[model samples]
Target: MSRRIIACEVFKPYLDKLLEESGVEAVDYLEIRQHDHPELLARSIQSIIDETKDVDEILLFYGLCGNAILPLVSKGIPIKVLRVHDCAAALMGSNAAYRKRFEGNPHKRYHCLSYGERDDEYFARTSPEYRKISEEYGEDNADYVFSMLYDKFSTPVTYIKLGLDGEESQIRRKEEGYYSVIEGDLGLLRRMLKGDDDHVCVTLHPHEKFVGIYDYEEILTTVNRNHDREKTREE
Candidate 1:
């Protein structure tokens, strides 16, 4: 069956690596930009679905980002989504690992990496939408909006490494309040891309609509099993 992936642009670097490593060919992608404006991504996803009528399954390199993927799934081709709340989980390598690190307030912390944001070029600051918000709501209100949008990476933040290389790693290391880099595994991504489906993927058949992430038990179960296997291998 032909497979396609509709991935967030933020996942580019990791996706590139996984594709090279997995050696799975015949995958296509619709790159959606990060940020909370779900409508744009929703539209992009729909456009791809319309264009790729021959695809047997669609894998989304997305989380249940602010209900962005909620409206995209339907009764047509099967859609596969990672069992994650956001891309941070993907970088952490699993939802369980992501939860363990940012246990207190999952939404308030940002996982800084080159693929997401390490050089501080946050999306909201430079996006055209930010300028539009400033014009419509005034600079004061715009800052407020930006703050709320990226409140996770707020002041006095600690950085954890998600395995992205280069200066971002160094900056994260020397900076105060920064935690040691926690290495992340790419096994889940590689499995999903290859249609392995051992765990960590929630497949929605055609004619079914995604209600919420409560439907992701199978995925988590699989990831947990994978984790166990990895531990055994290490031992």
Candidate 2:
């Protein structure tokens, strides 16, 4: 059966590479652009689900994403989503791997993104971007927007090094904040694309709400219970 993956635009490059490398045939994608808006994301996801009613085993390349997935349980179809807080964990392959980076540093406000995403003006928040936002919504509104979203973060925006060079990394860093580098691997993404196993994934059954899954126990319980359900269905 052909599978589908609805992913965020931020993960487009990574997902493209993983799917290509995995050689997973007949897989389709729907990329949503709502990194800053969770409501739109939820609506987009539901629309995609409605559009792809015939498709089974749909994969979502999303995390809790500010509770956007809270309302996106199952709409009578089986789907798999990573047990992660955000794409940061997906990029690192797992929550443990993503958290391991902060074992020593322990910066809660740490933000990670791909180098290619640095150019998105929506994420820029200054210069041409800020001017654009200010013109469209006024300077006061712009400040309010930034304050509500990005102001909470204090540490340098950490860029996940994914085979990019130092100069490119430097360009991606915002001038107002500092910069740091960390290695990233697509192991989890590859596994998902390759359909190797569900070790790092949780399959949601019909009508099951995806509240959140923070630890291995949560993942195991959800996945294992789903496995049993599948077995029962087969029987």
Candidate 3:
């Protein structure tokens, strides 16, 4: 079957390596900044799905991502998506693994190669909504504003190393704010690429709409469009 991958750009390095080894070249990497607006991110992905032609299946390398993928509909082609809360959980291998590390620490921040390398740039681009506050109040005040907004005081930062080159040193050089490192597993991603529709993935057949679930064990599921519409109306 002809398959294509539509993934977040943050997974580019790992996916690049995997795709090269597997000789799978049909992939579209979307900007990580789109994540700042869940609705816009969903629309962007839907546009890509609408534009793709002759592909029997699309592998989506994403988590529910604040429900960004919740509104996505399969336009004839089937879509397979990872069943994790976000990229951090996907990198950790599963939601259970992620919860083991961060179940009670809601204020903790997650850092991976992509996030660590572009820390400043990521914040600057993803938080354009705070630009006016920064401009009007100056940077120091902006920092305070952000801290208040996110409750970031003494927030622990966990960096997950997927054995990528230069990742260790980069973690060491990162400004120390309760920072630590842990090994990450890419097994789930590898399975996804290999078309394993196991527990870590949710597959949506043609015309099915993706939906987010509150339970971490289940993560996500799909429903028929008409059923989803009626459910929404009932709510």
Candidate 4:
């Protein structure tokens, strides 16, 4: 069997390009890529289960906003890999309140929060500016966003994209890690997904490696999808 790596929404193209050069097989590069947020992610995760007839290794990318990742960890997956990334502009202006919330739970799992204002508020929560952002968003801004990020990060994320499915996703899972789902068949997924063998396949990534992240800009120069440039301008 070939060592597969499935790239989610944002990282799919870059991974695809790399494979083109590496002569690597890119499976569900398109399948698992998803929009931001927890609900979408959960749906996407479920879809892979429904589509893939076999279990396989998966590589999943994630921001620090969803809360679902934690639950996925508790559940069973072959080998879950969580991608973590932090943005530079997002780190500015935060208060101690934000730090206390996230920093206290440092031991569980730490990944990049993606690049944006949300992550900025997330990182600077303890910097004294956190409260200000939270005040504008809410007292629980960090907690809420973090939870959402993890939700999308975890599972049940929906496929907001066009032209993707389970088999393609499996190919990627076999290669890269998607969410908490590692590469495994129905038998292995039964323990966690609670579905029939014919129903779903699991794609798991190692949180250690998944959580381990580098600058995305460095890897892919042209990664503009799903994210709303207009929204950024509005913010």
Q: Write the per-residue lDDT of candidate 1 for residues 1-235, one digit (tens) a residue.
A: 6777878776666777777776656444544443457877777776776676776888888777776676664447877888777776777677777777677754445544553353344444776767888899998888897777665465444344546565364554545654344577776677778785746667766555555534333332112324446788999
Off by over 4 Å in 3: 124-133, 149-153, 176-178, 228-235
Q: List the global CA lDDT of all models.
A: 0.63, 0.64, 0.81, 0.34
Candidate 4 regions with alpha-carbon error over 4 angstroms? 1-4, 29-34, 63-65, 73-77, 83-235
Please provide TM-scores, in order, for all candidate models, with all chains considered together. Answer: 0.71, 0.73, 0.87, 0.32
Cα lDDT of model 3 by residue, 77-168, tens digit: 88889989899988888788998987788777787888776564535424664676778888778777776644463455788889888687
Query: Tens-digit lDDT track for model 2 on 1-235?
Result: 5667887766666776676766645434444446567887888887886677676677877777787766675667777776677777777667787777655664544434443344344445664766888999999987887766566665565666555334364545456556565667788777776553667666777756565554533432233335557888999
Q: Pick the candidate with the highest TM-score.
A: 3
Superposed Cα deviation of residue 47, candidate 3 (Å): 0.6
Which model is ahead, 2 or 4, in terms of lDDT?
2
lDDT of 4 by residue, 86-201 (tens): 21111211112224334544432222212112233444446445566577788677566645545334332211221223334433432243322212111221221222222122
> Which is the better candidate, 2 or 4, if ranked by TM-score?
2
lDDT of residue 179 for candidate 2 = 57
Q: What is the lDDT of residue 114 in candidate 1?
A: 51
Best-fitting candidate, scored by lDDT: 3
**Greater-lDDT candidate between 3 and 4:** 3
| Candidate with more favorable, higher TM-score: 2 or 3 | 3
TM-score, candidate number 3: 0.87
